[model samples]
Target: MRKIFTLLTIATALLMAQCNQPEQKVDVSPISDATVKKVTAELVKQHGDSQKERIERGVAQVAMLWRITDGTETDFEQFCTTQFVSDDAALEQLFNKLSYGFEMLNGYFILLSKELMKPLHLDWGPVTPIDELFGSYNAAAHLNDDLYANKIAFITALNFPYYTLKEKTEMGENWSRKQWAYARMGDMFTSRVPAQLIQNFSTVNTNADTYISEYNIYMGNLVDDKGQTMFPADMKLISHWGLRDELKSHYANKEDGLAHQQMIYQVMKRIIDQSIPQQVINSNEYKWNPYTNTLTKEGNEVQATPEPNTRYQHVINQFKALKAIDEYTLKMPNYIQRKFEGEFELPVDEVEQLFIDLVSSKEVREAGKLISQRLGRPLQPFDIWYDGFKARSGIPAEKLDGITTKRFRDAKAFEAELPNILTSLGWSKEKAKFIADRVKVEASRGAGHAWGAEMHNDVALLRTRVPASGMNYKGFNIAMHEFGHNVEQTITLHDVDYYIMHGVPNTAFTEALAFVFQKRDLDVLGMKEVNPDKEYLETLDNLWSCYEIMGVSLVDINLWKWLYNNPNATADEVRNATLTIARDIWNKYYADVFGSTDEPILAIYSHMIDNPLYLSAYPIGHLIDFQLEKQFRGRSFAAEVERIYSQGRLIPQLWLKKGVGEPLSVTPILEASAVAVQKLSEKK
Candidate 1:
């Protein structure tokens, strides 16, 4: 055996949910052990000891997933003997081939899914029942099973033994780009889950996404107890991003600001409590004042029913479907481990701690005090979203909307200026055009998202809500954010060294760049902020907004923990628990700052209902955004963006260290924020 048993054990212990349980060693039949030993001996004799450790680990890892149905022990030995590449050049060649093959298989399937879900994703009239079915369908569900059956999967796994997250983090720094690519290749075939369970997981998540996408609150239909309307008659806001942004916009509202803010706040509470009239969800049949929980249509007050725990139903359904996958992923045994350690490459505990450090910081109380002083009033629960840092927040909301609507007019009009938008951010025209040409913009059914191409030739899709009238200020801002993602996607995909490594480490890194672009939305529109204290305000903005999202993310994490502990929790049980968790987080971190206790405002994120465990990215992204912003202060924005993003999919800490000067930490942001608070306080 090779002298690296420790790494092999670590590599094999890639359990999701951080299951500390011992990995069940593959109980190979005696014949199997004999065959593996025989193969390793011969391969060592042929390849020499330099390749000994890798050969021993690779052969055993592949054999671990092998079954009697995959053929007799003799067949396994024969396959290994035939497949094992002793020559270094040949093995490298095989890895490259596998990488390209995977790109094709994964890429085309993703594109197909994107096309099939177009009806559900795009604002193409109305979504049909069949569209939901198609959208929920996992087009690539059988790809894994088929690959396993065909032995291609076994071959890939044999050549490229999967490295565990720990092993990757430990050894990845010393690895060459190709070696890292090979390790990522090893990640391809770690599980042998049935296709049906995967389809169920897909269906549950798809349903949740659909539920959230259609969950529009008719803001215009929202009325106060005194029967006054504040929003535009045609305005329908999606919960809770649209509603949240709309609430943020009210900071600029001189006359009706506080009332609109209060109204939106009430609306959020109703949704969270499931007390919002069911009729007002995605319908214009009635006007409702969320404050009194009252419903009316035209001149007549109407009867109403509450939304029957559908939100929590989605959460529990996702919990059930994903939990079923736990038994199959014996290495990473649960969804929590799979999501954080596997997908995000972030440990749940570490992510949670980072969040708590920010939310529970003295900086948050200082930020709240700053907002209070500025508003000349005490903090409201909704003031967690204080949006005064951005240049547009100082401009009248209507004026900014006018400027954006005039500039964009429609999705195509915005699409036409993609290059100009990039150039405005200091990119050279050539580079801007290169990226813009490969990005396609479209109107979306939901708030919006950036969908990157899995294959290089494919264009990145930027989807954002463009109302029938025009692209409003909110839409433009989101589009700019998505555009940032698209740029990252294109650069990391088209310009990086390896197809397998062609993306940021995780969504947060992309989001960091997106936030960077989003902050410059005013600059892109020729409305730059001239405030000398703007940078300090921006730091406070980053910290405070991060504080708000951190609370929500803590709720998300705790809710998952609750689900895992109580696997059979009913929808109502999950609902009640979610509220309790939200309030607990709020009280722990936010009560003193916001002067509220048991506030369920933390439960208002739509991501919790649909995105499951994804809320953590926003806060982490904000931190990354702030740190990356620090990097660009004395540097060229365009150059650093290209250089930083082109590094492509290293682990988070490694990527941060290489991109910025430090690892992913709150110390920089917290320190800067303390100074910012002092400076701002002195100015006041």
Candidate 2:
């Protein structure tokens, strides 16, 4: 078998080289038992090492592939081919191992770095998942600067930076929307953050969730007022999952908990099957050619048909109209454009008119000056929406006095009654204690916080640290969010293959898990029952915010594609392009109902600076949350919740498939949006 393997490898290599020459076919034979055993052993042995070593080795190996000098595509591919020929199996194994091991190590390092910085008393916090996301683009931003300068020749050879931006712009103009969507997704996956470090210190974790709880309570006492919480009463702070009840009741079939699985499956099926088509339709990849009665694209020419009567179609039409306006606005005078920028120093009448033209509600415009005076910004049209969104939706800030005191006191009371809470959620006494023992709480001021997990043998740590924090509804909501993360992490990390598939697929997936848990925070707070009223309100909020942000993601992606396409575009041009995309998206998605026009607030998402392409995750995760929440409605949380989280590190598609018997997709969000719209319309 070993001999046959060698001959087959040689034949395949020879056939590739002989592509222009006469091709000679060779018979291939099966491998022997000894060879198979050796390969299997190698695979098993390669994956068991510490994550740190694996990362260092992988970096060193990739570094060896291309010279720092610029090289052509032919040169780079040739180098890759040569390297592959020498030890293909070894290379493949190393690549797979590094992919899994290093990313988790990245998480571990974040914990270590934070722990190290605290000793020096520097303003060092663990590198958040957010930081990692933004950091992914560091190499690209600095590619022409220091980081990739030394490798420019090599990069240019493969048309690295050149082709990257070129493709984005070219595709933006000509690619089919479906093709563009897939390509953009590929770009996203490839741009995963590189593992860099803050010295050798890194980040570490264990039991800090308890400490955070106490701290939040302490802080809330000092900073917040007595009447209402300063924090927004958003979806992250409320909702309940219904997994366990479905498992127990006859609502779903139960053979080895098949009912719970079916619930998840139904949700997954709804999301994936529906979302793809909608996204494709919304993506402006192809240009309509009326002359040919078709949609003309760069790669393919096709017959055109009327769009379906779908929400996505409306979104597309809105964007197309907005895009036209944006194109014209870019050529407008600076004074006109600056008025649209966050440079509002215009007269009161003008400012008010801009607000009227731009904001969803009049209250938002009134809230703007208050926000601007506090933030020390000259009120701009773009500032009206966000400040107003917060002001209009959030709990008042003055009502939060003594909220922290209540949190600790409440936590203590709740701690004593946690067993009952668990029982209510359908847990046996043994199961309840098993979960409660894993939890540890710390009292302080500010807000409650949770750490993922730290385990020593059978005793795992689930911590809630609310230091100087408040327990107002909003504060309680955040605490609930942290708690959700801790619960999901503890269950998934401990129960899964600890060394390999230890965590969920990406930050977005885990974010979805936390979102699912957050829905139940109100129940934990003993405020509301998990009934349809609460559920309907939460769902409406989700759709409202998600619909808003989807347009924001569109602005971000289009702006990036625009800027990258135009290499010579100045910072001014980039900014203008961004504003254009922002206004276009907002007008298309929201202008009619908001009773507003000519706004660019959506483009100003801080996420654009901190983490590009990340704004989409919020809306996407919210969508997933809605679907999963539906699955868990009226279900037993105690029995099925942990099991769901424990299926860690599976690809998003595979994870959903395993948990819910369907691939990951966007149908869930769209369907939820339609339902939310219908419900909301009825309310009006």
lDDT of each structure? 0.82, 0.37
Give the root-mean-square deviation of each candidate in angstroms. 5.3, 22.2
Give TM per candidate.
Answer: 0.95, 0.46
Off by over 4 Å in 1: 1-35
TM-score of 1: 0.95
Clashes of 2: 93
TM-score of 2: 0.46
In model 1, the Cα lDDT at residue 408 comes to 95
lDDT of 2 by residue, 1-684 (tens): 000000011111111111111222321213233433443344335444332332222222223323334254344334323332114366335434433443343344334433332322211344445543332221111121222234322222221111133344344345443333223222211111112211000111011211111111111111111222222222121000111112112222123323223332332222212221222232345433222224445646545543232222222222222222222122221212222221111222332232223234432223333344433445333222222222112323233324434644545544554455556556688767766566554432222334444222222222232323433444444455555565565666566643234556544556676666556644554544534445544655555445455666567656645644553454445555666777787676456544567565565343443222345455556656766676676776665666666766544544565565554444554455445445534654
Worst 10 residues of 2 by lDDT: 1-10
Per-residue lDDT of 651 in model 2: 43
